[model samples]
Target: MRGLVTFEGGEGAGKTSQIRRLAQRLTEQGETVVLTREPGGSVGAELIRELILGGTGQFDPLAEALLFAAARADHVRKKIKPAIESGSIVLCDRFYDSTKAYQGAGSTVPAGVIAQLTQIAAGDSRPDITFILDIDPKIGIARAGRRNLASSVSADRFEIEGLEFHKRVREGFLAIAAAEPDRCVVIDASRDVDDVASQIWLALEAAKPRFMRNAPQIRLDPKTDALVDDFAQAMKAKLLASQVKYGCSDDWLVDDWEGECQAELANHVQKGDPRDVANYAAFCWGRGWRASPAA
Candidate 1:
């Protein structure tokens, strides 16, 4: 896949407008842009989203997270993945981070649970650049209310969350961006739309070096996410078990799984330097893999 970018913010943070302007700007510069949104991007995901954002409120926090993950699995697997694979400039409205904020921080769900679930639903497909639009919830909620009035619909489940919830969501976004400075950039969403778009464009320009240096298909999955998740359900535990089964020390796998991998998988690996080969191997094992003699 090509480059992936996502816009994250509270409701009415001008993500829609900024995404549109950026898509148009990039298209004018002779790039193919595929603009999409989450929770309701693809057909299957949209259906799940109705149950989620519809007024029923039957879904609890954990259920909401699962539903979002299920929808995300479809959206990324069917829509976002294909666009990225085709080398299009893919811009997504919201991604996994929203769950971290809304469900994890704003409610009773755990962040680690959200992380693990995101892996199952999203695989390893992460954005090349993530722009978190920072804004106050008070102004944002009013804007969202106005938007709902114009659209002739009530505020959605997340949009209708109270002020404190939105504040926690904002702080969550900032924390994420701060934690992953290389992949995330925070911008003031309280600014004018044009001003916000300009910052986004500048950041896009700034990220070109790293983005262009990577492989063509940065994050497209070759197979189904279900196939990936079935194996990854107990991925960490499985890896620890593999250490005992294979007579490799925890320290050995922790420190040198990269050095232990087949050369082919080695060349294709992404993630941090000294990539966790044990984790990757666990991922492979989940997909019905076995250890090679060389490994």
Candidate 2:
């Protein structure tokens, strides 16, 4: 079973502090915990973070979204999957929801694009629970400013955004929590740190057992199901077209079709579920190809 928990909020919402406390608590309970944060989990992602937050270059909103998705793809493949497969409970500071809130909220990028990128990057994985720390933007900005004063370096690009932007970010978090109430639990961050942590712990307790029992599942609406089916059919057609175009069925099997179909199966089928694999193979065979001994 794989479990992921994420903490999200505007600046100065005590997300980092709460994550630390929770990590320690889980450790005490004999759970192997991996504490990580977005846009910095892997080497490639860390480089992207520097480009995003270092204030050195200008990035359009869509470009920024794409960069974020690229980073997430690398992070999930390198760090998140390995840790989860090792049976560690992963506590992430932020995840793709941050991108949706920050880049898709009011920017030029549409929410649909962000959602598609997140799905491709995450490959249907989702956090077991997400904590949204709600707080007044004015208070949060002031607190963040005070905290930044203690650091040696100047404020980064996002940190330099004015109060209005921060206010929008706060509103963005609330909107996200409302939209995904089942996955997101909103905590009043105006309360004391211990009180906020208690709220998060309660939310975790409610979600932990279910998360630890299964891999996270993605539920598709009709539109999304149609889109996925279209993608699969397109891929299949491309393989058949290549076979016809090249007039080489042997090369189709050796170099193209079988590998492509298997990759699709590996991606869409549940891991370690042999029944799904067999079913997928049968479906492919019924479509056209004769099953060989090797297949």
Candidate 3:
């Protein structure tokens, strides 16, 4: 099967250089490779990129996120999926992970909203393997600044974001790697280019066998489980409060209570894995929220 390989990192992580090198190596091995980047993979996406990276105009965080999701949707449809279907390996310099890390983590957008947007943008498609080049944000931004200085090009919006912003981005990448250890390989981008490439190669070698097998299942974190429980309790509390305030009869109570519970569950379901969460939501929706019978 054709594979999708994503290389992700903060600015100055040498993602561009390394991806180019990897593309060459793969091409030399007689594998067809399509190399692309996020925010501008297609023509429409390129327009969105101009708006996002120009720094000339202010855009709300959620608005920017929606723009990213729109671009990604088009890119996946026009470029990535077609390439993979044609037996070509797609090597993306960045992808959805960048959005989650940069826009979701760096901006004021709520994480839940970003998660839902990501699900919609990606649909059923996800990278077969992801290579996250990790480095200190300070070092990375310095490297990027030097490169910009050498090229006599002004810093773009993202490049102009101070070290702290980039630091958050770095942390975001690491968090993603931690969350999806099986799919994400963290490489030390602070090392020499050759060393970084070697690490990537080793990672790919190790991952090849797994890729050939069925897709790996993702495990839920205990924190996520706790969040679910907290949501349920909150729903229960809200329903009880509403019941006391409105003084509704049993029929009205069941209907209104169930509606409120479903709404709360829906909000949480959007952010979390829909497996158990969906089941729980379905159970709650089917069995209307009812108070215990009077003693």
Candidate 4:
């Protein structure tokens, strides 16, 4: 139903600002938008983000990469995956590409190592579209410096890196865009805010038919929310009963049934019809169950 869109670039490429604008525009268009950022989307990931960013040079290249992968694993499982499955357009400030660029290209970590770790962390969840805002490292770092000074905040680890390091980071992003042309859109980010936003919007509009148009029409009133909860519990109970009756002993499936059931509920809820919940009830409870005619 909904898709994940990520933004990536060097320091001060304005990924956060552009994400804000995109979320606002999408929300105004009646989309259910969940705005999140890498390294800190979930509670566990935020703690890891603080550890990684603040520790900075304390962690060696391999250790740092591992930390980032750990955080991403938590973020993807707890936040990003759920939002998209629930039919919310997820706009993330950064994602795995940043890891490859910063930890692989900008540091001593091997590209192969980064790729393997990214697979472990992100699994099958990848952005439907990625906007790579391109800018000169000199311009970006200067902008970052100015913003940090204005906000009375110290530069983060990546921002405080030397100009040459940032240049490597920029090259990394461009190379990614080159390799993954179908999923990556490189935008000129040296221009003013409005110009950058305009380009980003145009790209999103171009992608709408394929990526954004199929989201279920969610009429989420309080009653509907409650109905979702009720159906969820019913389906979970049914799943448990079926497993027991069939003498199934997949411990992992039993342990993680809540997530499985919720995913199924989300899939049904996004079937594009509001009355799909009524259908869901019948599906879960089988032949004996029927929706009221009014339902």
Which of the numbered candidates is closest to the native, going by highest TM-score? 4
Candidate 3 structure quality by residue, lDDT tens digits, 69-154: 99999998999888877667889989999988988787778889988998999887799899999999889888999999999987
**Per-residue alpha-carbon lDDT of model 1 for 1-295, expressed as tens digits?**
1478999988889888899999888888777899888887899999988888886456789989999999999999899888876768789999999999888878879988999999999997889999998889999999999988999998887886789988989888988988999999899999888888899999887776455433332132767555555544455455445556664532323332333233323432322222243344544354343554325
Off by over 4 Å in 2: 215-295
Q: Could you estimate the TM-score for every candidate?
A: 0.72, 0.71, 0.70, 0.72
Quote the lDDT for 216 in model 4.
Answer: 48
Predicted model with the maximum lDDT: 4
Q: Please state the error at residue 214 of candidate 1 in Å.
A: 4.5
Candidate 3's C-alpha lDDT? 0.77
Clashes (N, CA, C under 3 Å) per candidate: 3, 0, 0, 0
- Which pairs, if any, clash in model 1? 1-217, 1-218, 231-286
Q: Which ten residues in a row have the lowest lDDT in candidate 4?
A: 286-295
Which regions of candidate 4 deviate over 4 angstroms? 212-295
Candidate 2 TM-score to native:
0.71
Per-residue CA lDDT of model 2 for 80-121, tens digit only, reads 888987778889989998888778763567988998999999
State residue 181's C-alpha deviation in candidate 1, in Å.
Answer: 1.1
lDDT of each: 0.76, 0.75, 0.77, 0.79
Evaluated at residue 102, the lDDT of candidate 3 is 88
RMSD of candidate 2 to the true fold? 15.6
